[model samples]
Target: MKSPVRVMLIIILIILVVAGGTVATAMYLKHHRHQAATAATATHQLSAKEAAALQVSLPQMTTNLQTSGLIQFTVTLQADKKATKNELTLMQSQIEDSINQIMRQYTPDQLRNDKGLNSLKQTILKSVNHMLPTGSVTNIYFSQVLVQ
Candidate 1:
C-alpha cells in the first residue's frame, strides 16, 4: 500500500511539471507573436503616412561622382498635398536643378552606402523645400539607382 501511494504522488508531480512547462511555453510564444505584430503594424502605419503625402517623380539625371564613377538615379519627391499641380509644375525645373546640384556633391562610394543615401535624401529635401513657398517636400524616394 505504501509503495502504491508513493508511485501515484510521483506520477502526479511529473504531470504537474509538464503542464506548467507547456503553459509557460505557450505564453512566451503568444507574447513574442504580439510584439512582432505590433512592429509590423507600426511599419504599415509609417507607409500609410508616406502614401498620404503627394508624390512627384523627378526626371532621371546622371552626374559624375567627385572621384571616378558616374551615378544615375530616378528620384521621387513627396511634397505637401496643399501644393497645387500648377505650382509644382512651374517649379519642376528648379527642383530638378537643385537635386542635380546636390547629387554632384556626393561621391559614387558615398551614394552606395545607407548613410550616404540618407544624407543625400536630407540634402535634396531641404534644398527642394527652400525652393518652394507653398508646399514643402516631406520625403525623397529613389525609384531607381545606378552607380557605375
Candidate 2:
C-alpha cells in the first residue's frame, strides 16, 4: 500500500509534466508566428535596381612621329569596364587632354611601338579614372586609325 505522502508526490509529478507540455506548446506557436511574419516581410521586400548606365569607352590614340616623319602611323587601343559611359563621358575632356599630353611626349618611333601604345592606354585609363569619381576608361579603340 502506498503512503499518502507518496500518492501526493505522484500527483504533483503528473501536474508538473502537464505544465511543461503546455509551456512548450505556447513557445512553439509564438516562434512560428514570428517566423511567418518575417517570411511575409521578406516576400514584400523590393529587389535592387539595375544599373542602366553605359560602359566606359576607350578613346583611340594615334601619333605623328617626327622620327618617322615620312607619314603618320596608327596604334589602336581599348579598355574594359572601369565605370559607366556617362561617367567616362563626363571626364572625357580631361581624359582626352591626358591622351594629347601623352602623345606629345612620345616620338614617332615610340608611338609606333605596340608596347608603347599599351603603356599609354593604361596611363590614360588611370588618369581618366582619377578625374571621374564614378567612371573609368576601360578600353582604347582606334576605329579609324590613319598612321599617315
Candidate 3:
C-alpha cells in the first residue's frame, strides 16, 4: 500500500510529464509550419518586371531536314505582354513558314550539336520577330526536338 502523499506526488509528476510532451509537440508543429510557409513564399514570390512577361507555346512542327531525315519539335515563344492573342494567332501561319524554312537549312549533324542548336534557335527567333508586325519575340525555347 502506497502512502497518500506519495500517490499524489506520482500523479503530479505524470501530469507534468504529459504537459511537457504536449508543449513540445505544439512547438514542433509551429516551427515546421513556419518553415513550410517561408519556403512557399520564397518559391512563389514574383517581381513586378517578371509579372509583365508572357509565354506562348507554338504548335508542334514536323518538317523534312536538308539531309535524308525528318525533324519534329515543339517551340515556346517568350515575348512581352503587349503581344495580344489575336496578333499571335494572325501570325501563326507566317511563323510556321519561317520556322520551316529555317529547319530546312539545318542537317541532322548540325541539329545534334549544342552550338548548332543555339544557332538554329537564334535564326528562328530572328525570323519570327521579323515577321511579327505587332510585337517582337524576346526568346525562343525548343521544348522538344527530335532529329531522325
Collision count for each candidate, in order: 0, 14, 0
Any runs in candidate 2 off by more than 4 Å, and if so which?
1-83, 146-148
Candidate 2 lDDT over residue span 1-148, tens digit each: 5799899999999999999999999999999999999999656522222222334434554554544542233322232232456555665666666666666666656646688767766776676657766534445554443444
The lDDT of each candidate is 0.80, 0.57, 0.83
Clashing pairs in 1: none
Candidate 2 local lDDT, residue 41: 66
How close is every model to the real structure, measured as TM-score? 0.62, 0.44, 0.62
Best by TM-score: 1
CA deviation > 4 Å runs, candidate 3: 1-53
Lowest lDDT block of 10, candidate 3: 45-54
Q: Which tens-of-lDDT digit does each residue in 1-148 have in candidate 1?
A: 9999999999999999999999999999999999999999656533565554556777889888777888889988765564543466678988887777787888988988899999999988888777777767667899899998
Model number with the top lDDT = 3
**Candidate structures ordered by lDDT, highest first:** 3, 1, 2
